[model samples]
Target chain A: MSSITWQTVQAEALRRIRTREWPPGSRIPDEAVLAAELGCARATVNRALRELAEAGLLERRRKAGTRVPLNPVRKATFEVPIIRQDIEGRGLVPGYRLLTRAVEPAPAALLASLPAGSLPPGAQLLRLRALHLAGDAPFCLEERWVNPLTAPGILVADLDGISANEWLVQNTSFTGGDIAFGATNADAETAAALDCPPGASLFVIDRMTRAGEALITSVRLSYAPGYQMQAVI
Target chain B: MSSITWQTVQAEALRRIRTREWPPGSRIPDEAVLAAELGCARATVNRALRELAEAGLLERRRKAGTRVPLNPVRKATFEVPIIRQDIEGRGLVPGYRLLTRAVEPAPAALLASLPAGSLPPGAQLLRLRALHLAGDAPFCLEERWVNPLTAPGILVADLDGISANEWLVQNTSFTGGDIAFGATNADAETAAALDCPPGASLFVIDRMTRAGEALITSVRLSYAPGYQMQAVI
Candidate 1:
């Protein structure tokens, strides 16, 4: 009993679910009963059950007790890694080449995608276009717009050496962000940059990070053909 | 003090992080100190800090206290919902049409994806092709292969009214699964089924589910042009 932990209880509960000893749609024992049976504190049992419910293996409703859901919609989590690290993780030499760097007013579409009041009226943003390489081959094309008001350090930062993706991650303190995954056919410019045929299907990730009320940056990465993002549930 | 909860402690910790009071690269106070200051149990403070560490806002090292990360690699979680529920959640009418159904030996590539010993030698799989629609417009094309050994009930189940995606959720109790997102150029058959032009960019999701050692199903869903999956950190 002294050696019992929440993880131990969670493993036992999961084993029961996997073996169908506690079958689907059947209510699991209450927290107090499970605590007594497993020789652990009630809080330990509660924590174990709560985690399983969060993972969609168990269902808990107000005043209805807990049960295994008949149709559980599981969740998959992905760690959004830096592009350079992603390439290096695959045992490839990572390279970056800056193609364009300019300061301009953000487009209306980009502004609409961000949170309201992210930037002052008529504020100029730093725009960067770069290509990431894996083992001397084009990997991904990055198009980014950074709010100078939030990340003013970019004004004098050297773009040739460090990518904005890595720079902001190290310097910025973001409170929250949103991400989206989609597919797009490469236009002529993107195709030329990625060294792929025109209209090739490309996996795309769009992300916007924020610090309190200020928008840190908005960036889009278009991967070369056959790029896949994997996750587990 | 008696009314203090872990949620209360967690909210305070999040506020400190958001406001930069606990700046990046600085170790936070010990759990005992935080508990004493907040008039809560030590376990409650420990739980709150553990969650923040899991969310990538803080870095925790064994024997070294927790500290906010300078370059935090945040995580984004996406709920893998059933296709019908996905359409309905968008305020659209859901529709399904079965395209093909056959029992055949699993393909070599699919067999390689699952865990070892998922199927015995020469086991036949149930292959299904279907189109999911939203508001009379093509939304996605589903290609699924189900191992009959694990899900024998699927063979006798009427799939016309209910998709394998939904049927499996209702009947199967999976222990774990893997998912991947990618992009592909729509082939002729897929283009026709999705009512899009050939070579159109498509968002694709590939998934495999297992119950203990038995593989239940392997599915690939090709979404129509302009479909985007959203997530949050």
Candidate 2:
């Protein structure tokens, strides 16, 4: 209402806090003192402190005053991951090595998850077993199930230098899916493949990616337990 | 997949894992072997193993095999919180006593972020200083700002009976927010309110809540440093 400036005053308060001119744990100068120093009304200081407190940078209390906070816990947020992008982001050359690929009769249940139609001529299932390694050691062993009705070309898709993670994130926008996270022990195969001993712990993530009304892919990823999903929160 | 005969296979696998019949780190019979034993086809056994792996009970490898997991680190997840619910969820009676509430001139920036008028006419900035206690001592001191435009009748809102958190969750869906988590030393007021001596460590969550286009509410939550948030990731 006074046509008085706000940003300058807010900026001044922030500067004082950042510089520790008002050291944390110590109360900021009282309203009258801050008002005099800032050449503004107490309402202006109130606005500034209120905003900082909202930002988890300061704390306000009655009978005492406003002070700086020490640790901010929930401030950390989750970093959602898209694997291939994550690999490249980590400065790695992302490549997919097809260790085994085959087309066989569809498992009955898998076929049932599909539309209720008679199996096409030689309506075989395509099984692609691949190893995703950061450099030399295997990073993940992917056992993915793809529906031919939805992604027919995937049976012969060129995947030598690309990852399903990137390819999917690029070519399609799968609407939804369920994600499950847990821990398990690596069997002998996973142990040898991932270079860990049998019974070693591994972080497991099983996700079923979906489109509007279609199931796109069901993937199972096993990670060495040393893997960490750290978030600031 | 096969006449629901697969459910029995899944049940048997689950029972074996839990009973340690398939002892942790021990290899499980492969599809062909397991199918014969379970009186089902290899496909059914594969399905059972697939679900078990998905559930984190086993890790199936191509040539290796499936084995039980020992330590399920168990995923932990944390959702941003409303302090009171956070406290109560921890088995504490979330108590809030408003120390002060009134309509005051909106600070300039807040004024800009609020409705199209000067503190609106009857509008007043409601400042409520509340004490949140655990069992006997103060757990958190919440100093919140509520805009009358959005939080109409704020002056008469009954917060003593219900926590600000449960109410907000039921009453509104927030658009977005920014949170900063950090530690802070308690001041004289915070010290007295939280029953801690000055300079004691405290966890602080400073955050802003937005509704659609306007800044709905801003809150500062100060807690004892021992406070921890645990979630099933």
Candidate 3:
């Protein structure tokens, strides 16, 4: 307690919670009191409590003060990796194939996901359909749309070897983005490409990115059956 | 930038990166210099850049300084909600049914996931199976193992109306946990409860929690086909 850093404070507070000394639904002392006890600044105590709150261990509200969460739904974070790097990191040879590519008007799906004026009507975009592989096994089927405004290089870039998924990450910079995780039944085309039976369950990731008021790219990656994403909390 | 808060500093820096003014792979000015330019404290610039780095938009190294990430894989965070709250928040009537309950020895799956010395062999545990419903529609199937050592009340508690998922959350407190997301095919038993065809794709969530050195509970939740979890960055 003499070395009253936030890390030390966090450890002490976590020990109390884990041992149930400060039991569920109980409200512990406020920041000032805890800081005085620990011989630390109020900011240090606040930082520790704030982290516990973020970890879903404590719930803090104005006037009500901080209390152990009655229902602690823990958080688990998994990184969203670049496709090529992810495959190669698993000690497998990464490969990619461009199934189709075209320059066309913005699609309905692309228009609906972005803010107004981000992708104007009649705006031209480069559409790419590609398959990524881990060694000889089919990994994922990618359908992507690239807005020429943010990444014009896509208009004439040769994509025979590199996937639009990897290409966009390397060439374009985005200010903000969103990601979606879901499950879907494979259709005829996707099944054939992924070498899976029709109606097989596939894990899907849908991502959208924007660069300073302009929509950069939107892509859907459907993994072959039995894909799992995991992380320690 | 006369009014320079961390928010403003972060905004300006992000705009520069997005517009290619401080292009990717190029080093940016140090915190002291940027803070002086923006007329803010060095702590403010550090805070701003720290957040940008966490968002995968910037890279910070020791003596190497900070730079915009050449391949920014933007992050998106989604909250894992309690099943009842999730259902009720969607304006549906939440319901639960305890399908089965028993006191049994530790299962192989539970033992493998927990830390050593937690859940010793031949330990009698509370096993529960249940179903969560949203407006009469089968929502998810829950299979859970509760460590009686950590939560002894399960032996005498009435689980007729409340699910173990909710009951444990309300009663027991945990120190740490991990969660995993994946896709799996429904088996005959799960398929019947979920009203889905056998071998249909199901979204699966596996979770394990601990209290100090003791494992508290491990559970698996399987959602019927077409379950999507979405979040904005």
Candidate 4:
């Protein structure tokens, strides 16, 4: 037996499998039993089984018991983020230009999503809208809102140079948030910016953040389908 | 001296913004000054600014200081999960299904993604193509795999009435994983399964999971662009 204990159990599991001793779909011995057979602790066996389940090798449930998989694959999840970093990471220049910026009354949905009674009566929410471009192609359309009462200074920034992403990274911080993601048939406004027709599919993100005790920001982001976010850990 | 505390700081900030007291692109007070003014701690002010930055409201850097957004609204991130539960929390059936199952050799990319030399040579891998139907329509098409060496008993499962999601949940436990999400142009085969044309964009999730000491599962999940997972926190 090799000095390393866990690898040995993994090897034995494979050995038993290749010899067809356990057979397919038959529940393997429990952790306690496997430990006795392997001359190791139940923890080692548990670790091996846990890893296998994550890799789609085995399946287990509460009170249901564990077993080998017939077709042992599991679902994959990917992360999505801003476009400039996306382009630059591929060794390309990140560029941006504001499409529009205005201060308008927050929408009803925006209002509802916020904590009740965040704004004083007749508060005109500061709205900022812009399009992010990558290599002359429109990559995203960003529409965002700020509670002026929460953030007193929002009206004067150099919009021609930096993106909100870069600005935020360089200027402020994000502590915690609740975020949502979806795929949608693009609406007319997004279609116009993305150069795709309305009803085209788009990836959408909506989020709200609280700065400790302060409600800091609320935003809606839209991306042309095919933009992807990848994070390796 | 208000009941809201941080929310008060945030609400007042919004009011000041609406009146242009801070203006667009103007720097705001630091944590020390703001907390003193707001009668809070430096940590609390930091929290508010950090949140505002994420919401695309403020800009601060190591030396630059915090300021109002030219375009203060930022992209909000939402976790992607299931819709029925999201809708049904207001009460609805969180329904699901199984579409198809097959066994095929692991693809070259998939093999590379899997733990090298884990399986004995020339083992015909198990591939299951299952559709997750929510209510009556196709919600997701899950194509998964299984390594017989990991769990030998999977071969006996008659998945006609059962789902891979439910079956796997009933069978295995995993510690954690690496997840990725992005938009991809669909290939011919995947498009047909999702009912979209080849070259149309599909949201893709590519992830790998670890059991205990081994890489057990790797999968690519493709969804029609209109599918969005929403969450609240």
Candidate 5:
């Protein structure tokens, strides 16, 4: 045998759990005991166990030690890629067409979600509507709002060369954001853009980004029918 | 002023990113330099930076050092919550009705997804269909397949008191799994169960769980209209 690395420790522990040797909700040996049994340092065992704990397979407490999770709600991590990259990754040509550009008052829902003092009352926000394409077919429709105070240059920025989604990712500085996924029945305007029938179910991704305490942008992307997102846990 | 802790270090770093002090695609100071500047240990700075990197705000390479991510596609982490907990958390009484249960030949898709040698040829699998409820209204419909070889006791187990979802989590030990989210037009049977019109869009979650080399279960959960999932990044 070579040596007991953290990877090997993790694999062995996983195998034991899978075989019911350490059944669900049952406490496992302490880190020191595991380290001694595996002939490894306690730190190595601790690292391995910590990873499993973070993955929702094991639960740990200060004095109670670790136990296999009874109701393990596994988490799936997804990288929310930009529209162009997502399309290009599938061996398709990515393109976009800018449809509408105007200044408008922020909607009530948008105003409610924004942080207090982030935007002045009755401030005009730059609104843009565009269609993303995968070569000849429509991929998604983008509706976005840019807060003028957060992105002062957006009003005069070149909107033809690159999409607002791409531009925002490249130029905007945000510390955090929120995203939501849902299904919506396509209205006439969206149906016309995606070439689908009215009332067809479309996958929608809504996002809001913040730069520190200030809201940067809020966007909604409505994808064509049959869009699916997958992840491994 | 507060002493330099990991939280402070993280906050300072986020402030720099948000203010454009450390612009996108710009290399950040190394751990030793940042530690000296902040009057903290290198490990504290390392921990703070690692958290940012994991959150997709920074990218680190061995020789290249850390830099603000050029295209920060912020990740949204979602816990795959149990249906009962989800309903109960919403202050609704959680209930379920077992619609169908039978042993049948594995479907082609199920057989295809299962690992070779995990099951014998022409094996009978336990298939289940059930309706989960929030109060008296139908919440979602679940269709599941349990590999008999991996879960031998499932054939005769009392599935009425506990849902197959709950039972699997308690009894099965999975090493890894995959999950997918999409929207599907409900078929006649699914529409009947959910009390919706046929061809109405339904949010779907498909999952496959594996225990070491053995396949455990494959499940599809189709939710009623207006179901939405949100996450913060």
Candidate 6:
């Protein structure tokens, strides 16, 4: 019996693509042929190719066979890490300071960003403003509106020692979320927090997380100047 | 005989997580128990759970068993699509115009972005600047440098009608690449191309693609004001 796994088959196929042995726009061998050559099951080869096609690395037609894509629109995965971990990843000390915490009525814009019917009408939200520091330098300013009903623990959680960003990640069980990346001109208040010149361009991330039908939090994280988020494809 | 597949097992596991039947920070049932209950092979259950663990939705410890993550740092996948398709996806007419094409010595910064030893010293690169339009309005400005040696066909490719962004996608086969997203203060030239005021904050994407060890292209895309890149987790 062949003890080869699908991952081994996948690595071998990727090697051929990288080496240009199987050039772009050219059809690769049939699954049965590859299985015979690699001493694996045809099912194993099928599994490997299916994953590669899903990743946009290969193009598979119903009857035309599988070929390397000429222009592959690859999917890049970005992990949304906690701010403290982000700072620590850069070999800097992570510090958090809570700037403000208040319970206020949800704003119309905030309500529009959340899922419809996720929050009750006129529900009050716990708003938090905090600054994350990397080695005594301003790293990011976090402005968050948390649904107290969905995460009741936040109303009583300690905001001085830890950030709402970390606290919610530890307590909430979000089923799904949407995130947006864009650029914003830092206003005077934002510039003061980030310690950048007014009107400087800043990278911003806006996210809304939910647990089932219940909204958990809506947050905007504005990073200091020169912050770049990276990914691989 | 059971007809359960790994996908079916995975869906059931995900449903449990979404419903909070297996609450956060709690260990899920063992593989043997789940297989018996779900009437599937033990290997199927193992495969299903393994995928969830890899996705950061679950935490698996060898001796302690698997538990739902209390603080799941979920990953979001963004697809890098051709600029024309991106415009059309918004239900707008797509237009492209090539502004300039020149062959110039590769700059030190561009060479440093690529993998070391990917380019020979003093090699000339094909530089192309173009504008993408949505319904006759400025959308994005693309500044690209193509390694002529790696993509020789681009030297004579008809870039007037079709953009290098689209043309290269249809011709090049890159194995891996890196992308960075940030904010840039648009200069006078960039602002003119994007139809935005100078010093306005613009979202920028910088990418470097390679085929094995051979660098294929280095490109930067600057999106007009109010542009946002979105993803789901």
Query: How well does each candidate superpose onto the true structure, as a TM-score?
Result: 0.94, 0.36, 0.91, 0.57, 0.92, 0.91
DockQ of each: 0.74, 0.02, 0.60, 0.17, 0.68, 0.65
Task: Report iRMS values in order.
Answer: 1.6, 14.8, 2.2, 8.5, 1.6, 2.1
5 versus 6: better lDDT goes to: 6
Candidate 1 lDDT, B10-66, residue by residue in tens: 889988986679987899998989999999889999889899888888888877988
Q: Per candidate, chain B TM-score?
A: 0.93, 0.58, 0.92, 0.60, 0.95, 0.90
Could you tell me how far off, in angstroms, the CA of residue B8 lies in candidate 6 after the best superposition?
4.4
* Model 3 lDDT tens row, B93-190: 99998999998898787787677988777898988999999999999999988888898687788988988867777677666678888877888999
Candidate 5 wrong stretches, greater than 4 Å: A112-119, B1-3, B112-120
DockQ of candidate 2 against the true complex: 0.02
Clashing pairs in 6: A71-B169
The TM-scores, chain A only, for the candidates as listed are: 0.94, 0.58, 0.90, 0.63, 0.95, 0.88
Per-residue lDDT for B119-232 in model 6, tens only? 888999999999999998999999999998888799999999998867766676677788999998999999999989999999999998887788888999999998999888
- Model 6, A1-233: lDDT tens digits are 45699999998998898677888788999999999999988999998998899788899998889999876777888887888888999999999999999999999988776768889999999999999999999999999999999897899999999988777876666778889999999999999999999989999999898888888999999999999998888
Model 5: per-residue Cα lDDT at residue B37: 95
- Candidate 1: lDDT over CA atoms? 0.90
Assess candidate 3 and give its TM-score to the true structure. Answer: 0.91
Q: What is the lDDT of residue B73 in candidate 4?
A: 41
The numbered model that scores best in DockQ is 1
Q: Is candidate 2 or candidate 6 better by TM-score?
A: 6
Q: For residues A23-72, write the lDDT of model 3, one tens digit per residue.
A: 88899999999999989999899989988897788999998999987777
Over A4-119, each residue of candidate 5 has an lDDT whose tens digit, in order, gives 89999999998888787998889999999999999999988997998888878899999999998778877778878888889988899999999999999988888987779767
All candidates in order of lDDT, best leading: 1, 6, 5, 3, 4, 2
